[model samples]
Structure formats: C-alpha cells, structure tokens
Target: MTNIDIEIPHPIAAALTILVALCAIVTVDHFTDFQASAGGRAPEEIVRDAEGEGLRLRQQQAVLQKREEILRYQLEMLREERRLRGPGISAAIEADIDRSEQMLLDLIRDQQEAEGKIMLTLKQIWDAQGRAISISRKAGKGVISLTWPVEPTLGISAGFNDVHYEELFGMPHKAIDIPVDQGSEVRAAADGVVEDVSDNGYGFNSITIRHNGFATLNGHVESFLVEEGDTVRQGQPIALSGGRPGTRGAGHITTGPHDHFELIVDGERVDPMLYLPPVPN
Candidate 1:
C-alpha cells in the first residue's frame, strides 16, 4: 500500500496454510481414535471393578462398625458416671454428655446407611459385657455350670481322697471321693462333647466332658457307656463304675470301681468340693 503496488503472495504460502489445516484434521482424527480405544471396556469387566469397590466398602463398614461400638461404650460409661456424680459435677458432665450425644447422633446416621449390622454388633457387645455371661444353655445363659453335673453319691467310700479337684490338691485329699460299685452309673454333668475315654493315667475309665466352656473329668470308670462324638445331656449316663473295657490308650486312668471326678475351668482344674454335696464321714 505504501508503494501503491498490487503483488500476489507465493503459492507456497497457500500450500502451507492447506498443509497446516490437513495436519490439524489428522491430529483431531488420531485423538478421537485414542479416546475410542481408551473408552472400550466390557460391561462384565466394569461390573467386576464395581464389585471390588463394594468389597472395599464392606471392609470400611466393618471398621465403621467397630468405631460405632467404641463410641456407644463411651456414651454409656459417661452416662453411668454422670448418674453417679453429685451436684458438683452435674453441670459440666451434662454439657459433655450433650456433646457426646450429638456426636453419637451423627455417627448413628452414618451407620444406619451402612446397614443395621453396626447397631446389632454394638447391642450384642454391650449385652455380653453387661451380663458377663454366655448363653447357649437352656437355663438362661452362663459360661459356667451353676448346677452340679453328676450323681449326688453312689455310696461307696473311695475315701477322703478326692484328687480330681485341683483345689484340694494342697491337702492330702480335697474331695470326698465316692466309691461306686463296679458298673455303677456314671453320667454327664451337662451337654458336651466326649473329649476322650481312657483306661489309665489319672482316670481309668476317664470321660472328659466339655460343658459349654467348663470342663468335667471323670476318671476310674468301669466302662464307657457312649462312643466318641456322642452328645450327652445333664444326668445322661456316659459311663459306668470300675474301668474302661479296653485299655486302648484313650487317655483315661486305668483304675478302680470308683469314678475319679474333676471339675475344670478353661484348662486349669478347680475344686469340685465347692459344688459337691455333703458326704457322710
């Protein structure tokens, strides 16, 4: 324009513009191809991925459940403390309790959406701890057998030597051993599995009874009335006085017409005299 001259641009300029446009078009096409390849996943594979995510959620649910339990316990303990506290602590404790209650409300809302298992677990834990007892017995629930398991007295004096009791071990004899005539009735104190029937060792015709978690050992039996895996109930005769039929090394004591009885807890032997009835001297 300065020279007032009309000049045509080189064809190479137009060619270059077209070349740049083509390059851009080709780049866009390749980008679209990459997106298609990246997005191509089977429905089943996606479902599996989702299922894996669900499993992770389940693990999180378990953690949340435990947290909920801890929170609930704290709340209960605080409440109890507040109840026991006098007027001097009432105001401050009330405020703290309100705060805890609010926190628990939020937690409960979160847990509710995660299914009711958290609540159930918390309730079970509280109930178990609150009672300090185990159920699985007909007469309420207790880990220990409150009632005695065997016959009151078969009426033969095995003497004052009751060694089945770990408690009476300090003295020469702790139990009032009752001697049963050979083939006299021997029974299970409670419902349990037959741990073993042995003829030798401490118990001749020994039958180990696991009553819930408590244990009872009857040694020096005449014969085994029940086989292994046989379930026996309270007072169900599982053996007889005297000794086992065969000395197959069943872990029983090989001795006498009298059954040597031992009451055990966990694994340690406890004194049976605490529950046993009075025997005539």
Candidate 2:
C-alpha cells in the first residue's frame, strides 16, 4: 500500500522515449525484411519449382489411376464371385467389396488432392511466366476474327457448351472439340505471342497465346512446334493434336483423337465458335 514516485530530468526522459521509438521502428523493419526474404522467391525459382511440381503431379496421377483401375477390377471380380457362389460366399465377397469400395474412396480423395496441387502449380507457372496478360476490347482493336485451328476441317465432334460434355464431365464445355488424327497439326487461330505451353499430367496439354487483349488456347495437344515467347501468325502450325485414349497428351476425359480449342476474351473462356469461321457442312 506504499507508492514511490521517481522523477527524472525532462531531457533524459525525452531521450529515453526517442530511443524506445527508434527500437520499435528497427524491430518492425527487421520483421518486414524477414518476411520479404521468406516469401519473395525469384521468378525463375518459382517457375522451376512449379515445373517440378507439374512433373510430380503427372507421376502421382498415373500411379493413382493405375491403382484405381486395379481396385475397380477387384471389385468386379468380387461381385462376380458373389453372384456365382451364392449365399454361402456372400459374407466373404461382401467384405472384399466393402474394402475395395473404401479403397476407391481413398483413391478418389487422393486424386482430388493431386488435382488441386496441379492446378495450383499451373497458376504459379502462369503467374511467374506472365501468362495472365490482358488486353482491353479497345486495346484488342475491335472484333477479332480467327481461323480454324485444324486444317482439312474434320468437323467439330463436341461444340461449345455441348450438353453431352456437361453430363459426362459434370461441367459446361467451354471449348470446341474438333475430331482429328492424334498427330494432326494444330494451327494458331490468330497472330499472337505464345504465352504458355503446359500439360496437366492427367492428359490435358495446351498452348496458350496472347493476342492483343484476347487469348486463345489449343488444348489436348501432343507436342508443340513453337515454344513459349514465340511470335506466331494466324493459321501457323503451333502444335500437334492428341486426344487418343491411352496415348501421350490424351487425358482420360477425352472421347478420342481431337483438338480442344478455347478462346478466352478478357480472361474469361468463351465459345471458340464466336471467333472462328463457320464449320463446313
């Protein structure tokens, strides 16, 4: 219950206050520098890390898919055994089926996680490589016209927003699918700079080009003729279409050999038909 008060000289007190303030500022500056060093990776390093992630993602997808196929086969065998062996075998067969089902569920969860990682890696690559280029409509220079990406006009197998694609893929198809041989040459739709060339490992491979303010994507390509940063002209061959099942660059979702062409206007995927010439009858 005793209080003691000590009064120091005003000049000394002011110096102490200033010293404390300086220390606080120094602490904040040090913390900020630490954060920058931790978070600010060089763009080259980011792209390299993203590329490594992409490679691993592809390998993970292949392993998961093979496991899924094996599990599905085991389930089928179990069901057949239960059907042929009757009630006495029901208990054992049912147990096997349950185990297989749980495994499939786990595989699905893992596959989803792998998918997410690949997507994140792709975004990182895009960010590091300046793939998010946008050109305003005015900057794009009025309505832009594009040529068909594939020669010989094999005809569109899946039109943009096709109901079958939506039902099969569980999402609206934002691109046009043109049926062509697996190695058919894919041409650029318009004059642009190659922005990115990537594969999602689960079969989706694509080349993106930045055209003024608009961008075009040629997906399901087996190989690229042009590299990133290449300047291409309209109708120039840029890649080879590949969407054959069990083939390189052809993901599982594709029906067959085809080109998945997408046109992006101001960063939004729109129907490629809006820009391309009409399909031949």
Candidate 3:
C-alpha cells in the first residue's frame, strides 16, 4: 500500500479559481432576470408618466385649497355670529364655532398635504398650453351645450328686464338673477376659454367665457376658480356665488345672495331664457 499527494502549481490553481468565479457569475446572471435601469420602461415613457401624475396632483391640490378657503370663510361667519348673538346663544354658537374650528384645522392639514405632494411631484419630474389644447379638442366634440351656472332648484329671483335701465344701457338687466346660497359653486355655462376675470370697475367679481357664437357672464361671485385665459369645460366650477348684496370681495350690490347670469350674443346682451332650459319645479 502507498499514499500519494498530488501537488498542483500555483499558476494552474489560480486559473482554476478564476474559472470557478466566472462560472458562478454567469449562473447568477442567467437566473436573476435582470432589468434595465428604468425597470424595462423607456426613459421617455417614465418622464411622460411623471408629468401626467404631476398634472393630476396639481389639480387635486387646487381643489383642496379651495375647500380650505371655504372652511375658513365659514369659520369667520361663525365667529361673527357668536360675537353678535352674545351669551344668550353662547351655548349653541360655541358648539358651532368649535365644530367649524375643527373642520378648518382638518382642511388646512389636508391642503398642506396636497401642497406637499405637488411639490414632491414637481421635484420628481414634468405643460400648461398643451393641456388647454387637449381640453379644447374634448370640448369641441358634438354641438356645444350649456349647463346652468347655478343649481336649477333655485329659480330666477329677477326675470330678465331689459327696459329697467334702458336709458343708461339699452340692454340693462339683460341677465336674469338666480338667487343661491352664498359661497355656492358657480359652474361654467358651456365649454369655452375664460375670456376675462375682472374685479376692478365692475363692482363685483365677474367671469366671462366666450363660447361658440355666444358668451356668458357670471357676476356677483365671491371668488373665482378659473383664471383669465384658462380653458373650462361645461359644468366646471368657475366661481363661488357671493350671495346677497353684501360687500364681498367686490362691492357689487344684489338684492341678496344670487348668481347674476347674463348671456351675450354677437356682443349684444340677450335674454338668457332664450337659450336656457326652463327650471323644473
């Protein structure tokens, strides 16, 4: 019987080690199913997706911000009531104030979160005119239809009366006044570009949208949602009604909180009832 030890040279041993490492790497790579840096998506596609997300987030944030403003305004009203009512109604007023305060706080938090999301979205990636063009295409489908600027349940407070101020302006009172609760949403009558959003010299916040062969004016609004030059679809909220003849953001006078809706055709004031459907009882 004999025992033998096989000795290998250092160079051959090193070569064997290198071969094993190469084989291990190839096996791992083959089994792993590796992906591209962008997770098999094209870089351009990723950018486009990010931009879309950003746009959506911005819109959502805007909505949340509007809600916050409404809550704050409500809170102010509640406080004013509490002050005027005095302790006789303190118990009820206090409860309402407490609830309003809580709601306002919650809305603020939500708005902050939405704002943060928008900021993060912007940081991650990203079109103003392009969106407007897309909206235009979508709005152009079918014949243009108009939606009631205010809820139809509320009937016209003042019927169209052109002769009321015919001397000052031949077509004065051409617009019907549809009274609604203050701070109520005022939507677009039809798809169109926001031709103007003016507060100065008008005595009230007003939004005018030019549609096909006609235009609509929404006045006595508390606040505007859409800015000048923005494209809005029918039924989209353009402003909040400033109910009553109160001195709101603009000093526009009204019998009460109402939506002053005016229709203009070929730059001439016309009765809105001519085109608007009758309100359901």
Which one wins on lDDT? 2
lDDT of 3: 0.60
Instruction: Evaluate residue 122 in candidate 1 and report its C-alpha lDDT on the 0 to 100 scale.
Output: 28
Can you write out model 3's per-residue Cα lDDT over 1-281, one digit (the tens) per residue? 89997766697888899999999999767545432544767557778868867766665455344444444454565565567667787565467457645744664578665344334322321122222223333333244356789986868866788444222222225578786766799999988889767553323557777776667777777788989889889899999887332234323123346788876655356678877877989
- Per-residue alpha-carbon lDDT of model 2 for 127-147, expressed as tens digits? 422343342222364367889
Every candidate's CA RMSD: 26.4, 12.6, 17.8
**If scored against the real structure, what TM-score would every candidate get?**
0.37, 0.54, 0.46
Cα deviation of 101, candidate 3, in Å = 25
Candidate 1 residue runs with Cα over 4 Å from true position: 1-141, 146-176, 199-203, 243-256, 277-281
lDDT (Cα atoms) of all candidates against the true structure: 0.50, 0.65, 0.60
The TM-score measured for candidate 1 stands at 0.37
Q: Looking at model 3, which ten-residue stretch has the lowest summed lDDT?
A: 121-130
